[model samples]
Target: MRAAVYRRPGPAAEVLEVVELEPPEPGPGQVRVRIVTSGINPTDWKTRAGYAGRMPDGFQVPHHDGAGVVDAVGSGVAGLAAGQRVWLYLAAFDNRYGTAAEYAVVPASRAVPLPDDASDDLGACLGVPALTAAHCLGGNPEALKGQTVLVAGGAGAVGHYAIELAKHAGARVVATVSSDEKRALAEGAGADLVVRYTDADAARRIRDFANHVDRVVEVAIAANLDLDMAVLGSSGTIAVYAAEGELALPVGEFMKANTTLAFVLLYGLSPGQLADAIRWTSGALAVGALSALPVIPYPLEQVAAAHDRAAQGIVGKVVLRIAGN
Candidate 1:
């Protein structure tokens, strides 16, 4: 098998390369997938650059999401078979081989079967942002029916999926975007309301749009903390995923409103939280609630470009098209 391997942390072009290696056979409870599309995410680049944490030593394949066909099932695996099409999530969570290659090996449960009608593009987009969205709201989604939810940076990968997932769970989702283009993207994703994050009256409008903000799925929590705290309804939970730095809480106001501040990091999600993300995201994908995100493709040979593109904080998903259709 051929894969994008990084020996050390640095610029994508400087550190990443395609190398031929033995394709991994599935372990006792894992399955080997012939990767078609490897999804590039911010964390992939972050980890590669040692920005997320210290870079691992030795050869490492990157990417956590992919869509592919099952080629080999491990001895103890059940409910999946060779030739089945599946979407993979957390492909490199604790493993060395990730989706940024011709093949990847992951646990049986992480290889979700794809709906026949769904495109490989959609399947490739599901794992990280979609699951992260699900993890953020998965705990109390049932209670969110008829409630109002605010999603910061709605056009972002996580926030884009959050808008649709929240709506599918029956919340009236209000999304904050930086531009008209993003506003349209959020609207296309089924957000009930769209507002500019920089507007002077953004808080007032968000509060008015939904009566009160019942939940907030924030991508840029540090940048928008004051805005979120201002419009939060009583008993609201603010699920924050990304932050710039330390967040200073308004203890008195937060206490008075009984607000719950939550954080989501996909790797640290508890088993129950992960299960909910998988279960509910599966339903949403089945019903076409989750759509294919805009993609910027790079061939496996250009894995460095894929990493660079994803790290640019652009308005689309970056993918390594490893295998041709």
Candidate 2:
């Protein structure tokens, strides 16, 4: 099988190489998928750069989200079988053998049946961003309904879904974008209020618009913590997806308000949690309540370029078309 293998933890092009390796077969509880598409996320590049200072000891593949057909199934895998079309999550999160290849063998539990109406590209892109957004919004059910929820970085892939899901769950949604163009996109995604964050008064202005937001779906918690602390309602939950900076908490503000800080990690979530997220997200997708974010598509051989594009801030999900059925 041909795969994009990482030899080191440096620049993407220098370390990630397309090379032929032995094809893997499914283990007792696994399935071998002929990958049709692989979705790239920020974590893919961060992992390659060794953010935690841990690099793979040997050659390893990268990428966690994938859409593929089950070409083979192993013993003890009951419900799924060969020829099933599926969307995979956590494909290469903890391990090095991810989905950026001609074939990938993952645990049966990691694969979910693709919706009948969902395209492969959509399925591939939903695993990380959509699931994260749905999980964050769905975590606190009672307060989400009839509450004003602010989604920070609204034009982002995850933020876009956060807006949609919050609206679907009955929240009065407000989204903050960094530019005028993105404000329109946020509105299109159903945000009731769109706040532009281009001023020193942005946080104050946002508070004026929302009055008090009951929840915040935060993307850059580190960058936006002060503003978030200032605007969130008392007892509100700030579900942060990416902190990407110092781990210190807003001790004074949060303690004063008794706020709840809920951190979300889409990949590596426990099985039960992921199952519930998948159930809701699948329902939303099936009913057209959730829209797949814009995708920049590339052929399989352009995998490196896809990764670069994703890192360079492509508007939405970056999908690599592995093969066409």
Candidate 3:
């Protein structure tokens, strides 16, 4: 097996290298996947940079999302067998090996059966961003359904799914974007209303369209706090998944409105929360309710280039073609 290895943390070009390794077999309750597409998320690079200081002792393969076929199933793993097409999430979150290789071994539970209609391109997206999107909208997507929901950074991978999933949950969605192109993308993702973030009357536009939103799925909560605060209805919650810096809330204002501030991370979700996300997200993907972001593909050997493009903030999803079908 050929995999990308990083012995120590540093720049993507400096640290990531493609190397040959003996193919690994699945451990108990795990399955070995013949990787097809390796998805790159911000967390992958962050982990490589030692965001989690206590990393694995040996070489680390860096990717948490991918789509592939089950090459072999380990003992005690049920309902999975060789040749089953699967999509994997959180593959290297706690372990050293991810899908940035020709093969990867992950817990059986992390592999979801990919519907025939769902392309590997789409499967490559479900791990971190889509799951995070589902969790950020709250584990129960239908609870506040039919109410208005606000999504910040509608151009982002997570933001795109937040719009789609919120719409699927029957919420009227208003998405904020920085450009006309992003506005169109959000609108294409089923957002009921799309507003430019720079508009002076952005909050007013959102409030005018939906009156007040019941929930806000915020990507950059710190910078967009004012807008979120202005548009939230009484008893509403701002579910933040990403931010720029420290957050300083208007305590008095939010308190008067009974607003709740909540945060979520894909890697830290509870089992139940993870299950809920998998359930809703998988269903959404099955029915085509979610739209995959445009992808930029690099081969397994070019893993470093993929990381560089991701770190540079490419608008499209960056993926590695680990093995062709």
Candidate 3 lDDT over residue span 73-113, tens digit each: 99999988899999999999777779999899999999999
The residue-level lDDT of candidate 1 at 11 comes to 91
TM-scores, all models, native as reference: 0.97, 0.90, 0.97
Candidate 2 pairs with clashing backbones: none
What lDDT score goes with residue 5 in model 1?
90
lDDT of model number 3: 0.88
Clashing pairs in 3: none
Better of 1 and 2 by TM-score: 1
Instruction: Check candidate 1 and list the clashing pairs.
Output: none
Q: What is the lDDT of residue 246 in candidate 1?
A: 79
Ten-residue region with minimum lDDT total, candidate 1 = 135-144
Off by over 4 Å in 1: none
lDDT of each: 0.88, 0.81, 0.88
What does the lDDT read for residue 297 in candidate 2? 88
Which tens-of-lDDT digit does each residue in 72-139 have in candidate 2? 99999988989888988888866667888988889898888887777888778777887898777865
